[model samples]
Target: MKSEQGDPIPLWERSEPAVRPAPSPLSRDNIVRSAIALADSEGLSAVSLRKVASSLDAGAMRLYRYLSTKDELLDLMADAVYGEIVSEGPIVGEWRDTLRTIANRIRSACREHPWFIELLGGRPHMGPNALAMLEASFAALNDSPGFDTVDASMQAIRTVNAYVIGAVQAENSDLKNSMSKADWQKVWWPYLERLIATGNFPMLAKIIRDASHPSPDIIFDTGLETVLDGLGSQISR
Candidate 1:
């Protein structure tokens, strides 16, 4: 009802404003857009109705009309984040290839945002873009040879999504991830320095001495292929 600036905003707006409320000069879309920019620049912890309102020159209370709580706002934010992904490939191929493509697309979306992985599977059955992606997953299975049984198809979809979502979660983990990677590099470089210097750990040291680890993309592709291979066996039966 009331915005942080002490003005009234009804809540909800598309990317563009059709008509701006005179007093508050805000819409739901503007608030979300600004909030996204804030979150993208900062972290989700930095986002608040007050912060978004301030960015838009409105008041935080005004956001309450459409977004009752920050939780709702976050859901909206994640849904909004999903809208950014654009995957438009043919789905008529082998189910393995189809799902593989979908997983990569979703993974890349999470990778780019680095926020949606955790945002997903929370507050189930919410978020427009999230739902859309889920629907696409189910549709892919149904359109393939795995279409024999509903329960099996559902299980397969769920299993694949769990893996893809989990991959995103694993990649985006902050505290442990930072430490783990640093520790890996620490162990790797020093061990390589010594091993290469003293000629121990010959195999590992040789790979390390090659100037590049297998590379992140290579790792992702391998995991993606593994998941696809497992799925292929199920569908063929």
Candidate 2:
């Protein structure tokens, strides 16, 4: 019943809080949705139970009646974003294609909510929506002969998830540092050229002289294709 912090287990793992009928207009879903909106616009640091309650025109005590802590609210926010990854209909295609679609969707989601990678870094999210995403991924590979056991399928899923998360984090960092291809060439190219002139790194000098700078999108697609290709080879073997 106790968490590592010596407090009671979080709200997500606990039974729902009791509410009097027709007592308040706020619901857990409303609170979570409002929190997600705040996060989407202002970033995750801006999200707090007080701010969420204020946005909903409710009291912080009202939110506590549902979600016990800000961590639980973050769990809910992460799961809500996962809910957006649902397919309108059944995913149709080979396992590779299905996985590719899912991976790209994850990357897009991360781009949309730059804070998602940070929220997801600490622990596994097993909320309903998060579980549903895992279920869908398992379903995609269920019929694949390469994944004969649950372990194989799960390994493949983890590999794809790891790649997607890392790729998005790198992309987000580049954006934060203003190091896009154009930005890099604009701001750092002069210093880079001088470094190249020193001839300390011949390969880097050659790259600077001959190679075009890659945009984040280009880097992401190239890395994704490489990962998918490696996964395909494993499945075939």
Candidate 3:
């Protein structure tokens, strides 16, 4: 495949190289795996061709045979994590249930690999595994009773996906700001209390004082259900 610039397209558009006659210590899979491990442990900024190669005990230049650029490495890593998000078996039960399962899995995957969220924006992913997860979502909505057309299904997928991405991004941002629960309590909590005391933000103050703070999982589940409810209304229309 070719790009607008007429260069041979890499990443999702190209096939992996043929396996060597003799097995080698390095393969695209291992390189991507090592890079993912590094990202999971240290974050995305810490990942580089050199760093991943060092983790695999291979020279950085050797990785070029399998991956041309760090962007390609990141594409592979993101795709592999999508593979993790896929359900092990076919999604059964109602459409809402299927979508719920899919949404939760995506949220879980993002939480596990915070770096995945960083790669999620700016460009679209068309990798095999990323497409698989998307297909599952489309299929779920397509099979719904009221979602009769491809366009309707596509719109539904985008809406739910937007919610999941936005929610996870906000959740991760909050987590990053506070070093720990104790830190949040000690640092942010007082600042928030002071803001509430000013009385300019009465609604915010009310929530701060009266609302019960649920675990992140619960908050996510609640938000997911609210989004699903909105979709459910449209479907019932």
* TM-score for each of the candidates: 0.72, 0.85, 0.85
Residue-by-residue lDDT tens digits, candidate 1, 1-237? 556797864333223335456666776667778877887777777888899989888777766655678876777777776666534543446677766777777787776666566676666745566667666666767756667777877776667778787766766664335666677777767756866787666887666657565656676678878877887787677
Model 3 score (lDDT): 0.82
- Writing each residue's lDDT as its tens digit, candidate 3 over 92-160 gives 567778778777787888988998988875587878988888887777667678778998777767777
Point out the higher-scoring one by TM-score: 1 or 3.
Answer: 3
Best by lDDT: 3
What lDDT does model 2 reach?
A: 0.81
Ordering by lDDT: 3, 2, 1
Give RMSD (Å) of candidate 2 vs. truth: 3.7
Off by over 4 Å in 2: 1-24, 179-186
- Model 1 has an lDDT value of 0.69
Residue-level error in angstroms, candidate 2, position 42? 1.3
* Models sorted by TM-score, best on top: 2, 3, 1
User: Residue-pair clashes per candidate, as listed?
Assistant: 9, 0, 0
Winner on lDDT (2 vs 3): 3
- In TM-score terms, candidate 3 sits at 0.85
lDDT of each: 0.69, 0.81, 0.82
Could you give me the TM-score of model 2 versus the true structure?
0.85
**Model number with the top TM-score:** 2
